[model samples]
Target: MTLSEELLMAYDRQLRTDAETPSAIGIERLGPLRLVTFAGGRGFVTYQDLAGASARTISHWVAEALAFYRSDPAIARVEWKTRGHDHAPGLHGALLDNGFEPDETESIMIGPAHSLNVQVQLPPGVSLRRVSAERDIRAMSAMQDEVFGVDASDGNADAILRRVAREDGMELWVAEHEGAIVSAGRLEPVPDTDFAGIWGGATRAEWRGQGIYRALTAARARAALALGKTLIHSDSTEYSRPILERYGLRRVSTTTPYRWRR
Candidate 1:
């Protein structure tokens, strides 16, 4: 197998299950699926694979999983995370049949952590730091929400603060310019695994192409390396994919989130 395939295999083996939901408030099992509940009334569905179930069986699992989430009044929305490398049949149609809408597909990126640890020169007056204070975290979250075109609410910041309180080895990094956050990301080190994930990367539109995001990614990668993580992974949008690829991260696969709202 190629190096990218080998890395992808390692990701599937180690990053599924509990590693995928470290901040989960509760989890229940349905066949091979892990039904996860987060702090913000969000339900998530993931699994190693569908266990080679036939199309009919997969459809049944989808209905059952949807019912399981629907029963909980606290769950306002649920996301079924689908990976492109899986062999399950008829999953796209099954999701749509069950009132699930597919979101944008993202590239599954993986590579050596050290490759991203290299220094990238930032624009003048731009600097990177690891944020922990509630105020800083809140600002970073809001900046990300703006960049991603989501509502700037406290749900994500609250969840992140709770995770910080648990001391889960998740680091938040940001690039600040003129006292404002221009780029940000998260580094999560998976316990007992050689991998850490760099997630939630964003850059303000005006700041794009100035190397702020690249520096932020490198900062997160350095933090990962400091924690003994040799491999890094991310599900990257098109905006960030080329930057990661330039740093030696390979596009191993694709992932699309199917959303269901109550």
Candidate 2:
């Protein structure tokens, strides 16, 4: 197999379990699906594959999964994560029929952490560092929410603060210009794995194309390397995909989230 193919297989085997469900309040299994409940009334569905089930079987699974989430009064929203390389026939139609709406697809980028640990020059007056204080974490979360086009909500900040309190090997990094956050991302080093995920990468519109995000990514990469993580991965949007590609990460697969709201 090619290097990219090998890496993709490793991702499926190593990273697609309860390891992906950190901070989850509870989890239940249905066939290959992991029904995860988070602290903020959010549910999530993901799996390694469909277990070679037929199209009709997958459709039935989808319906059953949605029903499971709907039965929970506390679950206000659920996201079903689909991978492009899976044999999940009829999943799209089934999810839509069950009131799920698809979000934009993202490239699953993977590569050695060292490939991204290069020196990146930030724009003038910009610096990068790790943040854990509640005020700094809230500011970072707010900026990310704005960049991602979501309303600035206290729930997000609260959720992050709770994770910070847990100290579960998750690190938040940000680039600041004159004491204001310009770009931010988080490093999650999976327990007992060779991989660390760089997630929630965002830069302000005004700061785009100035390398702030790249620097933040590199800083997180260096942190991962220090922790003995050999591999780095991310689900990257178009704006950030090219940057990661240039840093030697391969687009191993694609993932799209189907969201259902109550």
Span of ten consecutive residues with least summed lDDT in model 1? 16-25
Residue 34 miss distance in model 2 (angstroms): 0.8
Residue 4 displacement in candidate 1 (angstroms)? 1.6
What are the per-residue Cα lDDT tens digits for candidate 2 across 22-134? 99999998898898999999999999888998889888888998899889899999999999999888889999998999999999999999999888787899999999999
In order of appearance, the predictions have TM-scores of 0.98, 0.99
- The superposed Cα distance between candidate 2 and the true structure at residue 192, in angstroms, equals 1.3
Off by over 4 Å in 2: none
| Candidate 2, residue 169: lDDT | 95
lDDT of 2 at 239: 90
